[model samples]
Every structure is written in structure tokens, then in C-alpha cells.
Target chain A: MKNFIFQNPTKLVFGKGQIEKLSELIPLDVNLLITYGGGSVTKNGVYDQVKKALKGRSYTEFWGIEPNPRVETLRRAIALGKVKEINYILAVGGGSVLDGTKLIAAGIVSDKDAWEIVLSGVAENQIPFASVMTVPATGSEMNGGAVITREETHEKFSFGGDYPQFSILDPEVTYSLSDHQIACGLADAYTHVLEQYMTTTGQSRIMDRWAEGLLLSIIEIAPKIKESPNDYELMADYMLSATLALNDFIRMGISQDWATHQIGHELTALHGITHGHSLAIVMPGTLRELKVQKHDKLLQYGERIFNITEGTEEVRVNKAIEKTEEFYRSLGLTTRLSEENVGEDTIETIARRFNDRGVAYGENRNVTGDVAREILRKCI
Target chain B: MKNFIFQNPTKLVFGKGQIEKLSELIPLDVNLLITYGGGSVTKNGVYDQVKKALKGRSYTEFWGIEPNPRVETLRRAIALGKVKEINYILAVGGGSVLDGTKLIAAGIVSDKDAWEIVLSGVAENQIPFASVMTVPATGSEMNGGAVITREETHEKFSFGGDYPQFSILDPEVTYSLSDHQIACGLADAYTHVLEQYMTTTGQSRIMDRWAEGLLLSIIEIAPKIKESPNDYELMADYMLSATLALNDFIRMGISQDWATHQIGHELTALHGITHGHSLAIVMPGTLRELKVQKHDKLLQYGERIFNITEGTEEVRVNKAIEKTEEFYRSLGLTTRLSEENVGEDTIETIARRFNDRGVAYGENRNVTGDVAREILRKCI
Candidate 1:
């Protein structure tokens, strides 16, 4: 196993009515700014609950942090934060709001432009922030990484910074989510585990088992959740699984392949596909194109996750890739580029963009522009 | 699932040559106290590594914290800490050294005696402490709980407080461990997962799967470790398993049964068994006595961990319990009180102690003194 250091300090306040913890979770003395997305929280009663919990506490509010959290939008939040002298932030909606608020927190404390911070790839400092996490996708609640898009440039990039001081995850809030949102969330979480798990085997046995466990739980709960969306236990599993998936818990002392996510980000940026849906389409393609490189792990994943043990090595690897795309399709998502109307022009654009930047992604750093084009061509 | 709040802030620095990070991990200004066990580190070269890492730093050293970590030995360390006004502590040996340092951390900051703090069941305040963990047992590196013995009264109790600031776990340091220590460490890690897992089913599917993952990893690594004790990957798995088994990561929003640990602590206090060995002997007894109450979970454990699916419910439960005992025995530890030469007198003493304390344990709070007696008899 490779050497690693791990530490996550986000206090997870989870379960029913945990939103009531907002008053205590956020500090009493700091100048607070509560950030939110478009008005879904109002319809879902999350806004009322958050307001009631923080009753009599003075704070500013910023709304309309979009899904692929645009940098153009977050710059305004940063300006508002600077004017208000906000020392702490409370993100009240989903992952987008929290991801935007991360940039806002960084912007409030530094003279760097919000887009510059994203380009820097790390925020040197940020004002403290907590969240009333209403969405389970992206795992922005507990992790330090955030992906923000530049609308003008049609680009999306992630940056690392301080984790939330606390995150209140009341699974009951998820009962108001749309089916499409739920599907995307499940796909995002499952792909998060695959990014950390579908690498070289034998690096860390515990990490492998843990990644598989999360995959198994996501797979088991995905169908049951469709049947019973309001079931407290099922949503709790989904919420917790998403947070644990990307919170550095399963990637300790191990090689990780986020090539699928890198390609998916381009799809989201260029064509405005939902983040998780893009992954559902692109992950299978990456797996199929890189099957030989990931052969051993694919066999293990096939056997452990899909019970595909009665096949030859090559057949098992193919079966594993097929089963992965099928799992995403089972989530009511389209697992092909053509299904989303993304064609060769967009694929070539992404490949040329990668070539222009001279970037090679994945565990072995071999997924160059040509490899990405091949992966996308397979998806088409 | 239950409402819960979870947070762990200990930074785990793992892999070879991590002890060199001590200078950067600890603060430069605090008055530091370095704590140790009975000089195992001296013979193992860990002592030289620690000293070399902190060469220019001024610190005090306290030695000779024995197994089970008695309050008697810790009081002197506490007194020394008070005299030196030590505000930071670094434990450089195994769990015993860290456990004793936990108490000393509490005692130095409070007016109450060390034993009083232990009996209080919670330390309200403690000076900051970190560890260079040399043993792969007890999980004191990442958790806030510590069990300390009162040698004068033959009593053992646990208390909870602040977690370590950081812990350095270099699996290479485990190469010097004796075979018996390795066996006991493996058993301790395995039993730790069982205490959290072998309760009611369906509280949280993710928690159950994660706990099972740890159990499977431990089971797979135990025999291989016996043959290749010096293997880095195997030892890394073992070390990481011990830390994760009790690190509050798997017990979120779930019922936990520490009854085996409760009885095992008594065995340690009375008969002077090693902590892990005591658990090995008492755990199977607890499972056998409480089989009816833990029926569903026992069946699940049997099916998942040992693949004992070819039997009736009762037969499967019995086989699970038997397999648990056999696993411990295969670790080269005796799993029965009779094999260890303890008899009815010691059993009665432990039962009377529990009865006098008026404590009922287990998930249902029904492991009373009578149940304790029955469990002990099963062990016999």
C-alpha cells in the first residue's frame, strides 16, 4: 500500500429533524451568510425548517446557486459576502449551493478572483462554513473538493479547500426530491465509489472491501428506494452512502481512477448534461475502452458486485462493464452519448481541449486526449 | 436508524517512515511529555526514530506503562505532567501507553484523582495528546475511549474524551511484534467489529456492510499473517483494520452490543488475561447465551462471514458461534475459561460485581448479572 495521510473533521448531524441543529451548529458570534439554490427549499419546507431553527439569529441570504454551480454566479455571492463582512457561511440547499459557497468562502478572505481560485486548484484559506445539506449527490457536504463551471468558457474544474465545520443531513428532506434528481444522485454516488475502487488491486484490502460494500449498498438500495422513496431508513442509507463515497474514507493508501469523472465533467460543461447523468453515460465507456488495463479489478468487481463468476476472464470483464451500464440504466438514465444527442463534434471538442491542456488523467496517467476520444467514441 | 452526531478529528499518518513527520505534526511551543510502555520500543528501534525526529525539541519522557494500563502507574505520570506543566503529550508505544496517557491527560487538567475520572465515565477536559502507534490493537490511536485498570481493586473501567490530535501508524514498525501479540491484535480487531455489528439487523445497511467488510478483511489476513508476519501489505491491513474497527465510522445511527467487552474486561481484571485474549474467551460465551435475542443478526453474520447457509436457523446460529470460537483458537488463543484454568469462583466473583453495580448490558439492556452468570457457565 502507498503511504497516505487521512483526516476529516466535518461533524455529521444525521437523521430525522437534524436540521433543527442549525442554530447550534453554526456559531453565535460570527456574521453568517446562508446560501441556497433556486427555490426548491421553499416548496420542500426545508427553508421554513431552517428559518425556524435559526430564529432570531441575524444573517444575510444569497439564493440561486445553479446545479453546475457557475463561477459567474458565485462571484456575486462573494461580492455580497465581502460587503456584509460575512465570517461564516451556512449552505442551505444541495451540493451546488455548498460547492458555490466554498468558492464564496474562499473569495471573501482573499483578493483572488473566484475563477482564479478554481484555476489554482487549491484554496489557500477560506472563511468557516457549515451546511444544511438537502441533497445527497456530489458529497460536497463532507469533502473539501468542489467543482465549479465557467459559463463563458464552457469549462468546469474542481478545487480543494477546508471541509465544512458541520453538516446537518436530515434524510426526511429528500422525500420532496424529483425522481430524476434521485436517479442522478444514485448514479453520482455509485460512480464516486467506482472512481476510487476500479484501480490496481491488492493495494489495500480493507479499502477494496469498503468500496465494494458501498457499491453493494448503493446497488441494493437503488431499486428499493424507487419503490419506497419516503422510507426513512432507505433515504438515510442513500444520504450516508453519498457522503462516505467521496469523503476520502475509501481511497486511503490506494490508487484511484477519476478519468470517468474528468470526461463526464466535459460533457456537463459543453452540453449542459446533469453531472451524475453524464457519469452514467461516460463511466461505462471508460470501463469498456480500458478493460484490458483494468482486467483483474473488473473480474473482482464482476464477481463481488454482480455475482458474475461463471465466465471466462475476458467474458467476466465484459460482463462487468455491461452490468455497470445496466445499473445506471436501471436508475432511469440513458447510458449512451446518442441517447443524450451528444455527437462527434462535442467529443472531438473535449479531446482537443484535453490535448491543448496537455493533461493525462487516471491512475497510471495514460488517459491522454486520444484515449479520451476512444472512450467517448465507444460511448457513441 | 437512530438520530446521531458523528465527528473524529484524528489525523492518521500511515505507511513506512511516517514517524519522521512527528516534528511537523506536533506543536513547537507547547510543553510536551512523551510517554512509553515497558521499553519494547527501545529494542524495536522506534525509540531512536522518535528521538531523531524530535532532535531539537525539548520534552520530558515517562516510561513503564504496562499492559491494561493501570491507574496506579498513570498517577505518577500525571503528577509529573502537572509539575512540568505539560500541555501536550505524545505516546510512543502501543495502546497501553496511549490509554494511560489519556488518563494522565485528564488528571493533569482536573482536580479529581485519576481513578475518580475513570469512574465518572467521561472526562470533561483533557490536554491535547497524539501518538506514534507501535501496536495494531485496541484502536486507541483513532478513538477517544480508553479502558484503564485499578490494580488496587482489580477493577477496570472506560472513559470517553478528546481524540488524539494525530497518530502515525507505520506498519513496518509491527514487524517486531511477537506472534502472540499479533494473534491478540487480530482477535481484538475482529471482536471490535462484532461488538458493533452483531446486534439487530437493518438498523443501517451501510454500517452492516462496512462492519462485515472489516470482519472479512481480518479473517482473510489472520492466517496469511501467521505465515508471513513480516509482509508489509498484510500488516498494513491488520493495522488499518484495528483503527477502523472502533473509530465511530461503523456505529453511526445503530445499536451496539458491548456486553462481550464488558464481561471480557472483568476477566482481565480478575484473572489477568490479556485484553484481546479475554475477549476471545468471553465472546463465544456471550454469543451462545444470547443466541435467541440475536437470532437474525447471528444468521446474517453466519451467512456473510463464514458462509454457513446450509442449515436451519438454529443450526446456522450454533455453527456461527462455533466458528467464532474456532477462529479465535486458530489465532493461537484459548477461547474457554476452563482452558485458562479459571473456574466457578472467578465466575461468581464477576457476576456478583456486575449485580452490585446494577448494570445491564447488550443492545436490549438485558445482559444482567444472571445473564452474565449464564454466559460464564457457557464459557466453562
Candidate 2:
């Protein structure tokens, strides 16, 4: 196992009607900014609940943080926060709102441009932020990562900042989500586990089991959630799984492969695919292209997750990949590039972007630009 | 899932050679009190590492916190801390040392006797403390629960206190543990997961899977660790599993049954049985007596952990109980009172203790004194 330091201090307030505790969770004296995305919280009654909870608490509100939350929108929130002297941010919608709020938190404390902070790859100083998480994808409620899109350049990049001081996850609030959003959330959570788990084997047995446990739970709940998205228990599991998936709990002392996410983010940037849908399409390609490199772990994952034990090595690996794609499809997601009308031109553009950045990803750092292109072609 | 709010803020610096980082982890402005066990660290070279790390930094050392840390010994440390006005504590030994430090942390701040704080069951204020953990048992490194025994009264009780600021867990430090200690540590970790998991079946699928994940990891590692106790990877898994088992990660929004632990603590208090050994003996008995109430979970645990699927309902439950006892015996701990040579008297004492407390445990709130007697009879 490798040397690592792990600490996540996000207080998870979870279950039914948890948003009402928001007023008590946040301190009384801070100048607060409540940030949101494009009005879904309003339709879903989350905004009303939050407002009622904070009835007389003084705060400023900023709306219009978009899906794949863009810096262009977040700059406005930061400007509002600066003028209001906001010391605390309460993001009240999906992952996008929280992602944008992370930037505003950092922006309020520093003179750095919001995009510059993304480019710098780390934000050390940030005003405190909490979340009333209405969406279960991206794990922005509990993790330090935020992927911000630059609309003009068609680029998306992530920066590390501070975890939310608290996140209120009322699963009942997810009852009104669209089927597509639910599908994407499940896919994102499942892929998050795979990215952390499908690396080298035998680094840490507990981490391996934990990563597999989340995979098994996601796989088991994906179909059940489709049957009953409003089932409080099912959505509760989904919400908690997403937060735990990428919150640095499963990656300790272990190698991780985020290559699929890097490629998927490009698909979202260039072609405007939903973030989680892009992963559903790209992950199978990653597994197939890198099969030999990931052979042993694939065999283990195949046996443990899919019960694919009664087959030859090649057959089991194929069955594992097939089962993965099936799981995403079972979530009502399109698991192919052609289905989304993405092809060689966009794939080449992503390759160029990766090449221009001079970066390699994955556990062994071998998923270079050309390698990413090969993986994408397999998706096509 | 149930309504829950959860947070743990202990920073874990883990791997080989992590103890050297402690000097930098603890601030130097406060009067520091370093606590230890009876000099096992001195022979194991952990003492030299800690001393070398803290060279040129002045601190008082408090030694001789025995296993199942007694409040009597801790009172002296608390009195010393009061005299010195020690503002920070660095517990530099095993769980017992840290457990005692937790009480001293609370005891130094108030005029109340240490035993009074233990009986109150919660310490609202405590000075900051951290640990350089040398044992892989009890999970005191990452959690706020502490179990302290009072030697004079032969009483053991637990209380909620503050978590450590940081903990340095170096797997290499576990090389010198006695075989009995290792056996108990494995059993402790395994039972910790069971206490959280062997309750209602469908409270949370993710929590069940995570609890099952820890159980499987412990079962797989226990025998291998017996053969090669110093293997870095195995010890690292063992260490990480112990911390994760009780760190509030698996118990979110779920009911927990610590009835076995409640009974086991009494056996440890009365008969001086090792903490883990007592659990190994009591847990199977708890399962056998409560199999009807815990039938579904026992069946699930049977199928998942031991693969005991080829039997009728009653047969499967009985086999599950048998397999649990077998696993503990395989850990080199006695599974029955007969094996430990403390049969009826110890059982009677434990039951009386529970009866005197007028409390019930388990998911059904029915593991009362009479039920405990039945459980104890099963052990005998």
C-alpha cells in the first residue's frame, strides 16, 4: 500500500425532511449566499423548503448555475458574493450548483479569476460552503473536486478546493427527478466506483472490498431504483452511494484510474453530452482497449460483481464488459457514441486537447492522447 | 434508512514510516502530554522513532496504561495534566492508551472525577488529542468512542468523547504484536462489523454491503496474517479494516446491535478475558440465542460470508452460528466458557450486571438480562 493522508470532514445530514435543519447547521453570524441552478429546485420544492428553513436568516440568492456548471455563470455569483461580503455559501440545487458554488467560495477569498483558479488546478483559500443536494451525481456535496466548463473555448477542467462543511441530502426531494437524470446519477455513481477499483489488485484488500461493495450496491439498486425512484429507501441508498463513491474513502493507499472520466469530460465539453451519459458510453471502450493491462483485476471484478465464474478468461472479461454496458443500459442510458451522434471529428478534437495539455492519466499514467483516441475509436 | 447526521474529522496519516510525521502534525505552542502502554513500544523501536521525531520538543510522558485501559491509572495522568496545564495530548501507543487519553482529555478540564465522566456517558468538552497508534484494535484512532475499565470496582463502561485531531498508523509498527493480541484484534474488527450489520436487513443496502465487505476482508486476512504476521500488505489491510470497521462509515442511517459487546465488556471486566477474546466467545452465543429475531440477517450473512446456502431455514441459521464460532476458534480464541474455564459464575455475573443496569440491546431491544443468560448458556 502507498503512503497517503486522508481526511474528509463533511457533515452528512441525510434522510427525509433534512433540509429543515439547514438553518441550525449554518452559523448565525456569517453573511450567507445561497446559490442555485436553473430553477429545478423551484419545481421540486427544494428551494421552498430551504427558504422556509432559513425564514428570517439574512442571505443573498444567486440563480442560473447551469448543468456542467460554467465559469461564465459562476463569475456572476462570485461578483454578487463579493458585493455582499458573503462568508458562507449554501448551494441549493444539483451537483452543478454546488460545483459552481465551490468556485464562488474560492473566488470570494482571492483576486484570481474563476477560470484562472480552474487552470491553476488547486484552490487553497475558500470561504466555507454547504449544500442542500437535490441531485446525487458528481459527489460535489462531499468531495473537493469541481469540473468547470469554459463555454467559449469548449473546454472543461477540474480544480481541488475544500469539502462542504455540511450537506443536507433529503432523498424525498429526489422523487420529482426526470428518468434521464436518475439514469445519469446511477451511471455516474457506478462509474465512480469502477474508476477507483479497476486499477492494480492487492494494494489494499479493504479498499478493494469497499470499492466492490459500492459497485454491487449500485448494480443492485440501479434496476430497483428505475422501478421505484420515489421509494424513499432506494433513493436514499443512491444518494448516499454517490456521496461515498468519490469522497476519498475508497481510494486510500491504492492506485486509481480516472482515464474514463477524463475522456468523458471531453465528450461533455465538445458535444454537450450529459456528464454521466458520456461515462456510460466511454467506460466500456476503456475496459475493452485496456483489457490486457487490466486483465487480473477484470477477472476478479467479473467474478465478484457479475458472478461470471463459469467461463474461460477471455469469455469472463467479455462478459464483465458486457454486463457493465448492460447495467448502464438498464439505467436507461445510451452506452454508445453513435447513439449520441458523436464520431471521429469530436474524438480527434479531444485527442488534440489532451495532447496539447501534455498529460497522461490512469493508474500507470499511460493513457496519453493517442491512447485516449484509441479508446474513443473503440466506443465509436 | 433512518434520519442521521454523521461527521468524523480525524486525519489519518497511514503507511510505513508515518510516525516521523507526527512532530509536524502536532503544534508546539501547547504543553504536550505523551501517553504510552507498559513499554512494549520501547522494545519494538517505536519509542526511538517517537523520541527522535519529537527531539528538541519538551513534553511529559505518562506510562503504564494497561490493556482494557483502567480509569484508576488514567486518574494519575489526569492529575498530572491538571498540574502541568497540558493543553494537548499525543497518545503514542495502542487503543487502550488512546482510550485512556480520551478520558484524561476530558478529565483535565473539569473538576469531576474521571469515573463520574465515564458514568455520565458523554464528555461535552475535551482538549485536543492525537495518536501515534501502535495497535490495530479498538479503532480508537478514527472514532470518538472510548471503553475504560475501573480496576477497583471491576466495572467497564464506554462514553462519547472528541475524536483525535490526527492519527499516524504505520503498519510496520504492528510487527511485534503478540499472537493473542493479533487474534483479538481480528475478532474485534469482525464483531464490530457484525454489531452494525446483524440487525434489520433492508435499512440500507449500501450499509449492508459495506458491512459485509469488511467481514469478508477480515475472514480472508485472519489466517494469512497468522502465518505471516509481519507482511506489510496484510498488516496494512488488517490495520485499515480495524479503523474502517467502527469509524461511522458503515452505520449511517441504520440500527446497530452491540449486545454482544455489552456482554463481552462485562466478561472482560469480571474475568480479565482479553477484549477481543471475550467478543469471540460471546458473539456466537448471541447469534445462537437471537437467531429467530435475526433470522433474515443471519441467513444473508451465512450466504455472503460463509456460503452456508445448502440447508433448510433452521439448518442454515444453525450452521451460520456454528461457522461463526468456528471462525473465532480459528482465530486462536476460545469460543466457549468451558474452554476458558469460567463457566457459570462469569455468566451469572454478566447477567446480574445487565439486570442491574435495567437496559436492553439489539435491534429489538430484547437482549435483556434473561436473554443474556440464555446466550451465555449457549456459550457454555
Candidate 3:
């Protein structure tokens, strides 16, 4: 196990009507800016609940932060935040809004351009930001990292900043979510755990079990959630699992492979695929392509997660990868690139992008530009 | 799932050589008081490492906080802290020292006596405290709860207070632990998970998995530690698991049954048995006595932890209880009252103590004085 420091101070206010805590959760004296994505919160009654909670509190509202939160859009939010002299940020919608608000929070307090912060891979200073987290994807509510896309260059990147002061996760708010959103959310969460896991085995036994426990719970609950979306317990598990996945809880003293996510972000940037669905497509390919490197963990994953113990080592690994793709397809997502009409040209573009950035991904840092092409081709 | 507000701000500096980070972790300007258990750290080299790190820092030293940390010992530390106007506490030895320091932190600030603070069940105000934990039991390093024994009354009670500002857990420090201490530590860590779990099923699937994950890691590591106690990775897992087991990460939305712990505390208070060994003796009896109430979770625990299949429902539950006792005994700890030479008189005394307090334990709050007697009788 590696020497590490772990601290996460985000107070998670979870369960039914937790948004009612919004008034007490956010300080009344701070100049607050509430950020949102589209108008889904309005239709879902989340907006009304939040407004009711923050009844007399004065706040500016910024809407239309798109999925795969765009930097171009966040720049305007930052400008508005600067002009309004906003001291606090409350992201009131899904992960995308929260992700954008992270950048806005950083940009408002620093002279650095919002895009510059993304490029630097860290937010120097961030105004305290939190979330009424409606979607269970990205884990932006509890974690310090945010992935923001630059629309002009078709690039998406993550930057580190302050974790939310608090996150209000009322699972009932997810009842009105599109089935596809739920599917993608589950996929994103599952992939997040896999990325943290699926590296070297035995680095930390507790982390492995936690990652497995999380995955097992996710896999068990995913189908049931489709059958019963409003089931409070299942969505509660989903929301909590997603937060725990990337919030440095399960990754303690272990290496992580975000290669799948790094590749998935390119898909989202270039072709505008939903973040989680892109992961659903890419993760199986990353597993299949990197089978030999991840052989032992694949066998364990196969047995523990997929119950694929009755096979040869090679067969079990292949079966694990296949079952993962099957799991994604079971979530109503296509697991192949061609099925989504994403072709070699886009794959080559992503490869060139990795090459241009001189970035190597994954736990071993071996997933260079050419290696990414191979993984993407496996998806094809 | 229950509505919950979760936040633990204790920074965990984990792995080898973490004690070197003490100077940086603790605020240098504050008046610091370093507390310790009976000199185990002196021989283990933990005290030297701490002193070396804190060479330039001015601090007062308080020693001899014995096992099950007594309010009597803590009062002296508290008095010393008050005299020195100590605003920061760094517990240098095991959980007892840390637990004692927790009380000292509370007592130094309040006009009330140390025992009065313990009797209050919650410490209203506490000076900041941190730990260089040498023991892998109790989990006092990462959590706000501390179990302190009242020497005068032979009463053991847990009180809530401020979490450690930071905890340095270097598994290397655990190498000097005696085999018995290791046994008790493993037992303590395992029972901690069971108290949080072993309640009703399906409160939160993720939490259950994480709890199970922690239990499985401990079970797998216990025997190996007996063989190779100094293995860095195994001890690291042990240290990490013990902290994670009781740190509110697993009990988020679930009802918890600490009936075993409640009974175990009585055993410790009356008999002076090691904390973890007391749990080992009490837990199986708690399971056997409350089998009907905890049937579903017992079955799940049996199947998941011990793989106790191929039996009737009653047989499986009985086997599960037996296996739990067996696991404790495997750790070289006596799991029965007669084996430890305690008789009915002690049991009755504990029962009377619970009766006097008018307290009920367990998830459903049904473990009254008479119920505790039944559980203790099962242990006999």
C-alpha cells in the first residue's frame, strides 16, 4: 500500500426532502449563485423545493449548463459571478451543472481564465461550492475533480478544486429522470469503480473489496432500478454508491486506471455522447484490449461480479469483459462504437489528440496515443 | 434508507513513515499536549519518532492511560492540560491514550469534571486533538466516539466528542504488538463491522457491501497476520480496516446493533478483559440469543462471510453463530465466560448495572437488562 493522505470534508445530507436543508446548509450571509442544467429541475419540482428552502435568501440563477459541462458556457457564468460578486455557488441540477459550477467557483475568485484553470489541471482558489445533486453520475457533488469541455476545440478535461461544502442528495428528485439518464448514471458509477479498481491486485485488500462491494451493489440494483425507478431505497443506494466511488473512499492507497474515462471524454467532446454512455462503450474495449495486463483482476472480477468461475483463465477474462459489455447493453446502452456510428476517423482524432498532449493514461501510464487507438479499435 | 447528515473531517495520514508528517499535520503555534498509554510506544520506537518530528515544538507529556481508558487517568491529563493551557492534543500510543485524550480535550475546556462529561454522553466543547496511533483497535483515531471506563464505578461508557484533527497510522508501529493484542485488535475490528451490520437487511445495499468488504478483509488478514505479523501490506490493511469499520462510512442509512458491544463493555468493566476479547466472547452469544430477531441478516452474514450453505435455516443460523465463536477462538482468544473463569455473579452484576441505567440496546432497542442476562447466559 502507498503512503497517502485522505480527507474529505463534504457533509452529505442524504435521503427524502434533504433539499429542505438547503437554507441551513448554505450560509445566509454569503452572496450565492445557483447553477443549473436545462430546465429539468423546474419540471421535476426540485426547483420549487430549493426555492421554498431558500425562500428569503437573495441569489442569482445561471441556467443552461449542458451535459459534459462546457467551458465556453462556464466562462459566461464566471463573468456573471464576478460582476455579481458571488461568494458562494450552489449547483441545483445534475452533475453537469455541478461540474460547471466548480469551474465558475474557481474562476470567480482567481484572475486566471476559466479555460486556463482547466488547462493547468487545478483550480488555484475556488469560492465555496455545493450541490443539490439530482443526478447520480460524475460524483462531482462529493469529489474535488470536475470535467469540463471546451466546445471550440472539442476538448474535455478535469480540474481539481475544493469539494462541495455540502451536498443535498434527495433520491426522490431522481424519480422524473429519463430512463436513459438513469442508465448512463449507473454505467458512469460502475465504470468509476472499475477505473479505480481493475489495476494491480492486492495493493490494498480493503479497497478491492469496497470497489467490488460497490460494483456488486450497483449491478444488483441496476435492473431493479429500471423496473422501479421511484423505489427510494434503490435510488438512494445508487446515489450513495456513485458518491463513494470517486470520492477517494475506495481509492485509498491504491493506483487507479482512468484510461477508459480519459478515452470516453474524447468521445463526449468530439461527438457529444453522454458521458456515462461513452464510458459504457469504452470500458469493455479497455478491458478487452488490456486483458493480459489486467488478467488476474479480471479473473477476480469475473468470479466476484459476473460469477464466471467455470472457465479457463483466458476464457474467464474474456467472459468478464463480455459480461461487462453485456451489463452495459442490459442498461440500454450500445457497447460497440460502430453501433453508435462512431468510426475510425473520430478514433484517429482522439489518438492524435492524446499524441498532441503527450499524455499517457492508465495505472501503468502505458496507454499512449497509439495504445488508445488499439483500445478504440477493440470497441469497433 | 434513513435521512442522514454525514461528515467526518479527520485527516488520515496512512502507510509507512507517516509519523514523520506530525510537525506539518499539527499546528505548530498551538500549545500541544502529547498523551500515551503505558510506555509500549517507548519500546516500539513510536515515541522517539514522534519526538524527532516534534523536536522544535514545545509540548507537555502525559503518560499511563491504561487499556479501556479510565476517567480517573484522563482527569489528571485534563488537569495538566488546563494548567498548561493546552489547545491541541496529540495522543502518541494506542487507542486508550487517544480515547483518554478525547476526554482530556473535552474536560480541559468545561467546568465539569471528566466523569461528569462522560456521564453527559456528549462533550459539548473540545480542544482540537490528533493521534499518532500505535494500535489497530478501537478506531478512536478516525471517529469522534470514544469508550472510557470509570474505574471507581466499574462502568464503561462511550461518549461523543470531536474527531481527531488528523491521525497518523503507520502500520510499522503495530509490529511490536503482542500476539494477544493483535488477536484483540482483529476481534475488535471485526465486531465493529458486525455491530454496524448484522441488523436488518436492505437498509442500504452499498453500506452492507462496504461493511462486508471490511469484514472479509479482516477475516482474510487475521490468520495471515498470525503467520507474518510484520508484513507491511497486511498490517496496513489491518490498520485501515479497523479505522474504516467504525467511521460512519458503513452505517449511513442503516440501523445498528451494538448490543454485543454494550454487553462487552460490561464484561470489560467487571472483568478487566481486553476490549476486543470481550466483544469476541459476547458477540456470538448476542447472535445466538437474538437469532430470531436477526435471522435474515444472520443468514446473509453466514453465507457471505463463512459460506455456510447446505443446512436448514436453524442449522445455518446456529452454524453461523458457532463459526463466529470459532473465528474469535481462532484468533487465540477465549470466547466463553467459563473459559475466562467468570461466573454468574459477574453476569448478574452487569445485568443489574444495565437495569439500573434503564438502558436497552440493539437495533430494535430490546436488549434490556433481562435480555442482556439471556445473551450473557448464552455466552456461558
- Of all native A–B interface contacts, model 2 reproduces a fraction of 0.92
- Cα-based lDDT at residue A297, candidate 2: 94
lDDT string for model 3 (A1-380, tens) is: 99999999999999998888888888878999999999999999999999999998789999999988888899999999999999999999888899899999999988988889999999988999999999998898899999999889888999898999999999999899899999999999999999999998889999999999999999999999999999988889999988998899999998999999999999999888899999999999999889999999999999999889896899889999989999999999988899989999999999998999897999999999999999999999
Please give, for every candidate in the order listed, the TM-score of chain B alone compared with the true chain B: 0.99, 0.99, 0.99
On lDDT, who's better, 2 or 3? 2
Two-way lDDT contest, 1 vs 3, winner: 1
State the DockQ of every prediction: 0.92, 0.91, 0.92
Which residue pairs clash in candidate 3?
none
lDDT of each residue in B67-130, candidate 3, tens digit only: 8898888888888898999999899988888888899999999999888898889999999999
Docking class of 1: high
- Per-residue alpha-carbon lDDT of model 1 for B1-380, expressed as tens digits? 99999999999999999999999999999999999999999999999999999999999999999999999999999999999999999999999999999999999999999999999999999999999999999999999999999999999999999999999999999999999999999999999999999999999989999999999999999999999999999999999999999999999999999999999999999889999999999999999999999999999999999999997899999999999999999999999899999999998998899899998999899988889999999999
Segments in model 3 whose C-alpha atoms lie over 4 Å from true places: none
lDDT of 1 at B366: 95
- Provide the interface RMSD of candidate 2 in angstroms, 1 decimal place: 0.7
- Worst 10-residue lDDT window for candidate 1 chain B reads B361-370
Report the Cα lDDT for residue B83, model 3. 92
